[model samples]
Target: MIEVKHLHKTFRIPAPHLSRWERIKAAVTGDGAEKTAVRDISFTVGPGEFVGYIGPNGAGKSTTIKMLTGILHPTSGEVRIDGMSPHKDRRRVVSRLGVVFGQRSQLWWDLPVRDSFDILCAMYRIDRQRQQRTLAELDGLLGLGEFADTPVRKLSLGQRMRADLAAALLHEPDILFLDEPTIGLDVIAKRNIRGLLSKVNRELGKTVLLTTHDMDDIEQLCDRVMVINHGSLAYDGTIGELRERIGLPTILRVSFEAAVSLDNATEPELGFTVAEANGCELTVHFNRQELPALEVLRRLERYGTAQDVHMEEPDFEEIIHKVY
Candidate 1:
C-alpha cells in the first residue's frame, strides 16, 4: 500500500542577473519568490490497484512521483510506501519500487538490452538464476527477446520502452510508477503497452500508478483516477464518476435545405448551447450528464426536417479539460 498525508513541496527560485548591491537588498528583503510544485495533497493506493494520475503540463505530476520514489524530498508532510517513509528509509523504499519515466531512460545508451538487465540485476543484487527466470517471463509477456540483443540507442521507441519496462521488473518490484510511459508511441505500440500493463496489474497483482496525457490509457487500464491541477488535488475517484461529475458535452449537427428555428426545442435545464448557425445548417451542444443523446435527437426533430443529422462526442482531451 502507498499512503500520503498532507504532502507539500516548495522550491525557492532565486532572482537572477541582479546587481551586487541589489542582491544584498533583495536577500535582506527576501525578494526571491517560492513556488510550490506540489501543495498539501493526500491520497492512498492499495496493493494491486491501477490508478491514473493526470494533469496538464507543469501540474506537479512529476513532483509527486519524485517524492514518492525518494528522488526528491517533500518540504513538509509525509510520504509512505507500504508503511515506510520514502525519505527516511530511502534504500528500503527504493528496493520495492519500480519507476519508468518516458522522457528519461535508466538504461545505458550504448549497452545491449540484455546487458542493461545484467547491470540492473547487479545493482539490485538478484541472483543469476532468478534473473534468467524473470527474463524468460518478461520475454513472454512483453516480447523483449526480439530486441534484447540490440543497443539501447539502436532500438526503436517501442522496443526501447519494452526493454525499459523489463529492466524495471527484472527484480520484481512490488509497486510500479510510470510517468508518460507511452508518450510518442503509435496507436499499435500504445495498445501493446496498455495490454502489458493490464496483465502486470491484474495477473501479477502489482500496484500501478500511471501518469499520462493520453486519456485512452486511463479509459482502458485505470480503475480509478486522480487529477492534479495547479499543485492541488482537483479530483479523486473512478473514471465513471468523473464523467458523471462533469457531464461531458455532446454535439448534434443538423443539415437542412433551409434554416430552421431553435425556439421549438425548449429544455431550459438541459443546458443547450448554440455552437453554430448558418443559412442551412444548425449545431446544438448539450451535456450528456444532463440528458441522453436519444432525447436530445428527438427534441431536435421539433426544429424541422433535417437533411442529415450527425452526433459528435467531445474527445478525450475535452473531458480532461472539464476536470481542470
Candidate 2:
C-alpha cells in the first residue's frame, strides 16, 4: 500500500531583476518570494487499486507525482511507498515503482527498442532468462515485437509509448504510475493502451495510479478518482459519486423527424429544463439522479420520433469547474 500524510512542498521564486539590497530588504521584512506548489494533502492507495489523479494545469499534480516517485522531496510530512520511506529508502522505493511520463522518455534516444530493454536489464539487474521471459510476455500484451528493432527516434508516438510501457514493466514492478499515457494518440492507439492498462490492473493484480486529463480514462479504468486543484486536495472519491454529489445535468440532444412540439412550453412531466429548442431539435439538461437516460429518452419520444440522438455526460473539467 502507498500512504501519504499531510505532505507539502514549497519552492523559492527567483527574481533576477531585484537588486541585492532589495532582496535583502525583502528577506528581512519577511516577504521573501516563495510559492507553495503543494499544500498539506493526504491520501492512500491500497494494493491492486486503479486511481486517477486529475486537475487543471499547474495544480500540483505533477509535483505530487514527483514527490511520490522520490524525484522531489516533500518539504514536510511523510510519504511511504509500500511501507518504505521514499526520501530515505529511495532505491528500495524505486524498485517497486514503474513510472511512465508521457512527455518524457526513459528509453535511449539513439538505441533500438531491444537495446534499450537490454540496458534496462542491466540497470534493474534482470537475469537473461527473466529478461527474455518478460519481453515475450510484454510482446504479447503490447505488440512490441514488431518495433523491437526500431530505433526510438524513428518510431511513431504510439510505438514509442508502447515501447516505454514495455520498458517500465520489464522489471516487474508492483505499482505503476502513469502520467498522461494517452496524451497524443489516435482513438485506436488510445484504446489499445487502455486495454493494456486494464489487463495489467485486473489480470496481473498490480496497483496503478494514473494522472490524466482524459475523463474516459477515469470512467473506463479507475474505480476511484482524486481531484486536485490549486495545490490542495479538492475532492477524492469515486467518479460516480462525484457526478452524483455535484449534481450537474447530463445533456441529451435530440433531432426529431418532425418539428418538436415543445417550442416554448416549459417541461412539466419530468421536471427537466429544455435549455435549447430549434424547430426539430431540442437540447435538454437534466440531473441523472432525477431522471436516467432511458427515462429521459422516453419523455423525449412524446414530442416526435427522434431522427438522431446524442448524450453528453458532465465532463471531468466541467465538474471540477463547478466544484471549485
Candidate 3:
C-alpha cells in the first residue's frame, strides 16, 4: 500500500548572522550548507503488512515518514500510497491514511473526547451510524469509554494517547502511520498501545508503517523491519534474518553439580565463549547457526554433572545497537 523510490530529503542549515554587510553577502552567495535527512532510501509495504521503520534519534526515520505522508516534500524522489502520489494528490492519498505523532494531538484540548470525534466525523463526512460503530469498536479495544466524556486537557497521558489513536482510525483508513506512538507511557500503557496496534494491524488488516525507538513494539507487532542509520537503509528483513546477519549471539546458562576447573573443561573444535563463570555456574555465548545448542550441551556434559540449563535470545536493544 506504500511505495518509495530513491527518496531523499535535504534541508539547508541557516548561517549565523553577524553584520548587515555579511547578511547581504550571504543572501547573494547562499551561505547555508545542505544536510541530507534521508538518502536514496527505497522500500515498499504491501497491503495488510505491518512494517517497523527504526533508527536512532537523528537517523531520519521521522523524516522519511513525513515525506511518505505528504507532510514534507522529498528533495528528489517519488512516494506513492496505493499507486497514487502523495505529493501530487495529497488529499486523495491522505484520505486512505491515518497518522499519529506521539508528541502531538489532533484532538481539541478544551473539548470532550467525544466532541472531538463528532467534529472529525463531520469533517470527514462520515455518517452518524458509521461514527458510532467506529467509536463502539474503539471503546472495546482501547477502553476509551473511561475518558470518552472527559475533556482532552483533563485526560491522563495514556488516556489522551488512546483517544488520539481512536481519532486516527475513526475514518477507517486503509493505512496507519504511527511515529513513536508509545513514547512516554508507563509499562501498562505501553502494553495497551502495543496490543491495540497489533489488533489494528492483524485482525483489522490495516497496512501499518510504524516508526519507533521501542524495539519491543517492533518485536511484538512488525512482521518485517526496516532499519535506517546515517540517512541510509541499514537493514531490511525479518527479526530472525537480522539476528543471523548481525551474528547476534544466543546465551546458554549451565549450572553444574560441583565446582568445575576451567583448565580441565574440554573445549570442542567449534568452541563458545564464556560470558560469565562463577563457582559451579557458567554462562556461554554462541552463535546457534555455527554451533548447535545440542552440541553446546554435549560439550558442557563432559565438564561436570549438569544441574540445570537455560537459554535466551539476544535482546531487542542489543539487536538495534548492532544496527547502529
**What are the TM-scores, per candidate, against the unseen true structure?**
0.84, 0.87, 0.95
Residue 245 in candidate 2 has what lDDT? 93
**What number of backbone clashes does candidate 1 have, counting pairs of residues 3 or more apart or in separate chains?**
0
Q: Across residues 251-291, which tens digit of lDDT does each residue of candidate 2 receive?
A: 88999998887743474766678888898999999998887
Error of 2 at 24 (Å): 13
lDDT of 3 by residue, 224-322 (tens): 999999999999999999989988889999999998677744455637887788999999899999989999999877668999999999998898897
**TM-score of the candidate numbered 2?**
0.87
Candidate 2 minimal-lDDT segment of 10 residues: 262-271
Candidates in descending TM-score order: 3, 2, 1
> Which candidate's TM-score is highest?
3
Which tens-of-lDDT digit does each residue in 204-302 have in candidate 1?
A: 888999999999999899999999999999999997778677776678888876677766445575457777878778888887777777786666666
Please give the distance, in angstroms, between residue 118's alpha carbon in candidate 3 and its true position after superposition.
Answer: 1.0
For candidate 2, the clash count comes to 0
The C-alpha local distance difference test score for the whole of candidate 3 amounts to 0.90
